[model samples]
Target: MASAVSENPFGRSITTEDIVDTLGFFDSWEDRYKYIIDLGKELPAMPDELKTEDRLIRGCQSQVWLEPSEQDGYFEFQADSDAFIVKGLLGVILSAYNHKRAGEILDFDIDSYFDELDLMRHLSPTRGNGLRAMVQRIREIAGE
Candidate 1:
């Protein structure tokens, strides 16, 4: 398995509360978008070696790769995307799911979080579906 480092920070230093509060600070959607993109920049670099066909998430308009590592009960995920906004979306999702236990991942009310972020209202239909797809994929992994 590939080791995780700066490639992910969610559920560690970057909590869901942090994301929510930071997003709430912005008055304009434009600024919020920039913040989301900046979060994407924090993803570090995902190795090309790990971006395999099997790791590619299905139903995304853009190509997204997700890989998970779990030990005992804790879980962490490393994900990457071709689109900048999609990468940001991954960061938002990871903020909830990554580095959490299976139960925590499964129990997180992602819809409420997104609602709090006012995310779905600003997203395109395809982007909304893609976001749901990413969440679904992670949820399946945690279920296993």
Candidate 2:
């Protein structure tokens, strides 16, 4: 049988650098947010059956589910969220972590990346916490 990992190919081609460049191009946070939502729209839909309780991530202001798998030392991720902004946030996080080797994912300075984006400062505390939760979970999966 084909693995669950294979069933879901990461169709998003945007890279972290692409996000950074795009964010830089936007002068206002509102524009940046729009871009983010656009990015979320690019994420392929995860199968409804895969969005089970086990995949549900806690501590998010929005309902988010992430299912991960490993192949040839790289990680594959499939995620969805009830909120548009949160789904966009997932897209951002995925740009950083998806299809990366565990060491690369671990070595990445996510906080610095956020700082560069000036992202956390604009987010509500709850949303910020939720973003952190998603990052933490990805790290945990990478560390495994």
Candidate 3:
């Protein structure tokens, strides 16, 4: 999966650098939605076993599943949801922290990232809260 990211320059790898790069490209929420959905398409499928009750994200209006595994020094994630926009939001998040160390993920300025992308203001209240819940869940997993 990492190799796939390396192969496509336009398909930004799940990294902070890529997120910064992506926010620079899209000019509006509509364009950003297209970009985010494209990111979701790039996500590797979540394993069926990892999609169980324990991995479910709470506070989400839609069913969301997220699983994290640490390999070497980084955390690898697998996530999915029944809702399309939520899936896309998960993709946006994975782009920022997937395959990165817990400390790094914790250190990221998520609010700044959202502000730069102009994301939360445009999202519905429920979706915005879901996004916060997702981040909080990941932070708890990181023990940060």
lDDT (Cα atoms) of all candidates against the true structure: 0.86, 0.86, 0.77
User: Could you tell me how far off, in angstroms, the CA of residue 89 lies in candidate 3 after the best superposition?
Assistant: 0.8
Q: Which stretches of candidate 1 lie over 4 Å from their true place?
A: 1-11
- Candidate 2 residue-wise lDDT, 1-144, digit = tens: 101122224444567778888899999999999999988888989999998999999999899999998877778789999999999999999888887778788888898888888899999999999999999999999998
**Lowest lDDT block of 10, candidate 1:** 1-10
Going through the candidates in the order shown, the clash numbers are: 0, 0, 0
Task: Give the better candidate number (1 or 3) by lDDT.
Answer: 1
Better of 2 and 3 by TM-score: 2
Encode model 3's per-residue lDDT on 1-144: one tens digit a residue: 121243222334566557657768877778878777777777788777778898899999998999887777677678998877788889888776676667777877888888877789989999999999999998888874
**Model 2 ranges off by over 4 Å:** 1-12
What are the root-mean-square deviations of the candidates from the true structure over C-alphas?
A: 5.4, 5.9, 5.0
Instruction: Write candidate 1's Cα lDDT for 104-126 as tens digits.
Output: 88888899889889899999999
The C-alpha TM-scores of every prediction are: 0.90, 0.90, 0.84
